[model samples]
Target: MTAASIVDPMFISGASVWPLVEGGKGVAASNGTSAGAWAAAGGVGTISGVNADLIDDNGEYVPLIYKGRDRKARHEELVEYSTKGAISQARIAHELRQGEGRIHLNVLWEMGGCERVLTGVLEGAKGLIHGVTCGAGMPYRLAEICARHEVHYYPIISSARAFRALWKRTYHKFGDWLGAVVYEDPWRAGGHNGLSNAESPDQPENPFPRVLELRKMMREMGLDQIPIVMAGGVWHLKEWMNWIGNKELGPIAFQFGTRPLLTQESPIPQAWKERLLGVAPGEVALHQFSPTGFYSSAVRNSFLNELYERSERQVAYSDDPSDADGRTVFLPYGRSNHGVYLTPADHARATAWMVEGFTQPMRTPDGTLIFVAPDRARQIRRDQADCMGCLSHCRFSAWKDRDNYATGHQPDPRSFCIQKTLQDIAHGRGDPIDNQLMFSGHNAYRFGQDPFYKGGFIPTVKQLVQRILTGE
Candidate 1:
């Protein structure tokens, strides 16, 4: 393959540099060390602001310990830790860069206490962070926050409709500080995606059309000069030559979230990096199992498979016998509750599952009951009881950050605690391949075919950047 001339530099955050950026990976995957090196290579580097890791003055990793009597207290502690961690990472990234490239901090708008954490980090870090990139929700207040701090803001969006809504609602006033709009493909992106109900996960749409549509909308709104950072499924610049210098699309940049995982500077554990080499095509699955109630893409490993099985073991139920689709059947759950009403077929299925040791029946918000083994049921209850309110609203724990602080429904058993799993995977506290959520893009399988990674060769951040510029 011939290397394309990627000499067109773009100005972002007071610097004109290569229009390439490192997409932020959360839960300690993208840290200060890696982001700093990316910026040093003359590209935008993104530091994850989702419970980022921090180090002590003695050079030891500071363990995040939450000692709260309840979820509210734990949430407070989480925000404090998150803010401090972001500030620490920003300092380290700035020091390492020494004023080269640009450093952007990424956060999820759906994350618990988002406002508090954003304010805290921006207040503490000050000039260290040049821009803030937010995704996973319609962050209407992000522009205002960035403007107040005199920092640039990039709102990660999936559709033109979403961007228009943001611009019309709150961003129009602070339009100058609006750095760029990141159009992360919801169907193919790693981590939690923002696919609405109108969009089907089974059918993937072409990003070019979607992005071009976005540019059209932006131009109509007088945002013609702003760059659109295309994220998700972007592996090579050569493949995207048509998007480059296209007057209709305007200024554009590419954000890589998966390719950089194998770099030497990547903060993920060695085992996780090695696992990437073995990923084959179609190994990644996009599903709605996140506690945040949003669809996320991840490797179909043991952890994801277990969640699938748990959901499969579920059956809908009714409070009265007559509501059981006319043909009423009693599903004897436990010795005390007697059982709920179900159809004859469902009753037989439930009986079979119970015989197979799935004796524990649990209620869900959608008038369904999922049966699991006694041990698994106990674990689920424990996890729910130990909810830390990591998300603004959790499907697994039914915990909300506002009002009564409850979803007013039973916690669903199909989902698991995202915070617990992400923390475990990031810290290498358990099996890397099994037992934890492994966020990845559908294009992750290309790792095996890429010649740059032939014979299990892992490159440094600088080497990876140079190779990418070669249009490989």
Candidate 2:
């Protein structure tokens, strides 16, 4: 490949650095150490703001423990903890960068207390953070928040339609501070995806056309010079040679989320990193199981398998017999006069599941019930009861940040507590391999075949950056 095929150092939102960037991962996956080293390597580093970790005065990590008795109190503690953690990470990253490169903070708009957490971090870390990259919802207020902080803002979108809606609604007024627009391929990206009802995960489309659409929209709106950061499904610079300096997609940059996870400076546990080396093709599954009600891509480990099976072990039901199928039978569980109406076929299936030790049947908000073991059922209930308002609207617990803090629906047994699992996995507090939510992109399997990582060599952040610059 020609030298021009590789990305050259350029100015991005006022910071001069290599166009390469480390995409943010949540629950402490991408932190001060990783982001700092990446920036020192002359690439843009993104520190995750989703429940980040805090460091003590002696440079020791501080474990977050909630002492509140109720959800409301715990939620308040969560906001406070998140804000402090973000600020601490920013400081560490800034210090490590030593006035080189740039650091950006990433947050999910659907995250609980997002506004409060963003305000606290930006205010607490003032000039340390250069930009804010946000996704997972239509973040209309993101521009306003970044404007107030005098930092650039990048809105991660999956479609041109989504960007158009944002620009028309809010981003238009704050165009001066628009740093860049990120186009994360929903079906291929790791972590939580942004696939809407119009797009199906099974029907993956070419990112070129989709990104061209985004560029066209940006050009029409007078944002042509602003770079469009292409995220998700990106592996190496050589594979994307045509996209480099393509005039049709002016000022394009590539963001790497999965490739950097195996570097020496990556903060993930050793076991998690080893797991990445052995992943096979098609092992990562894109499914709708997040409490935020968004599609996410993760490894099909036992944790994901259990959730998939839980949804499979479900049957539709109705409060009134006449409202459902012709066969009406009282659900032999719950209080008297609270029997649900179910079909004869579904009743038989439910009975068989009960005989298999899945005796506890829990109702979902969508007129269905799933059977689980008694202990599992108890754990689900406790998890739901101990909700810390992690999301603005939680599908698992039926919790909302506003409207009296309730969604007015029965808790869903099909979904699990994301806060508990993500925290558990990130901290390595439990089994890392079998029963944890491991987020990854579909192309993660390439780790095994990539020649740069032959003999399972894990390079340092600097080495990795140098290797990437070779157009490998």
Candidate 3:
């Protein structure tokens, strides 16, 4: 019952592993290099988000060679890209397999052709990948899919209740092959957070009791021995040692998200790494403005700053004519200029941008757009037409097929295309301020309190894992 009595399990599902898990990040943050480094340290590492097919010929990312007439004829081109990427990642893991650490892949549940993409990676990566982690929606069939492929499966969840639902309906029979469960703090994690609108964004519950409850639920279902990986805002291990060896908590583990981002091998832009160094505690915020409709954490980059400012000045409206309705009205861009309410400063900024011909066009769910730039607009249109149908209802495609119902609302300008921003950031876009949508944990400010990290030195995966494991 005591925190000191918690037990940190060495491995999950009979696989050799460390107590730490290198949390999977999307858009190339957690690549083969970072994952390989973590696996080399005897911990589990996950590479995720459309695993880059960028290969090295002589220690450099090389372009694949393909000949095609049209897009369909380019099938071989895309397949070659995917194969090269999967192979590079597998080779990296193989190089570090001697440490007896486990290697895994985390795939987003909503990504297009999830089954084919995962199967491709697994088939290409046969012996190297030990497990698969999935989240961002209930992966009801993931257990069966991974089971068929003979790989362990971990479903990332925020609450014990959600796990119970999944177990009863899907994973309960899988038993030993179920691997470990990852409990990511919905309010404090980077990337797509799992919190719903009903939950209080400002108040986060202490994870210790929540995790214990998860253990108890697992016990009731005859799954008590499974490890629970704690993720989100986990930095110092010494502070968490108090939870080690606790009986009520059962087998425990920790997954680090933002902390891993500062590692030298992490494939993020240098400017982004430097930004995290200067972040103060409470500087990172959990906001619910993502196009995916999920809450995510990030430092106040220029993109986020503009979003926050616009939201703060946002006024609500109702159809009632009475002023007593307490509803304010807003005008659609390029519509009647009157009755449009905006803060004086915001109005001025919008007016200036418009006057300078920097117009904001409607955006699609996939982030494609018809902008003023003719060439760029053409590209956006092409990209939109080439939709992989990644999301259930892509706002970009204006694709809606639910009972033939339609919102008829155009794409939102308030939100930028996630694919574009994340891609740019991952590929080393120099403008950290303008282009990238950086994600971080709420505890990012603590970096300033630690004297050893003064002015920020990018630590390698080995250094971070060692620090956490040794309770430093």
lDDT (tens digit, per residue) of candidate 3 on 335-404: 5653344344444554554465545433433322222333434544665444333443444443332333
Cand. 2 TM to true fold: 0.97
Question: Could you tell me the TM-score of candidate 1?
Answer: 0.97
lDDT-better candidate, 1 vs 3: 1
Question: What stretches of model 1 exceed 4 Å from their correct place?
Answer: 1-7, 335-337
Q: lDDT per residue, candidate 2, 124-161, as tens digits?
A: 99999999999999999999999999999999999999
Question: By descending lDDT, how would the candidates be arranged?
Answer: 2, 1, 3
What is each predicted model's overall lDDT from 0 to 1? 0.89, 0.90, 0.68
Q: List the candidates' TM-scores in order.
A: 0.97, 0.97, 0.80
Q: What is the lDDT of residue 122 in candidate 3?
A: 78
Better of 1 and 2 by lDDT: 2
Question: Candidate 1 residues 244-298, lDDT tens each?
Answer: 8888899999999999889999988887898889998999999999988889999
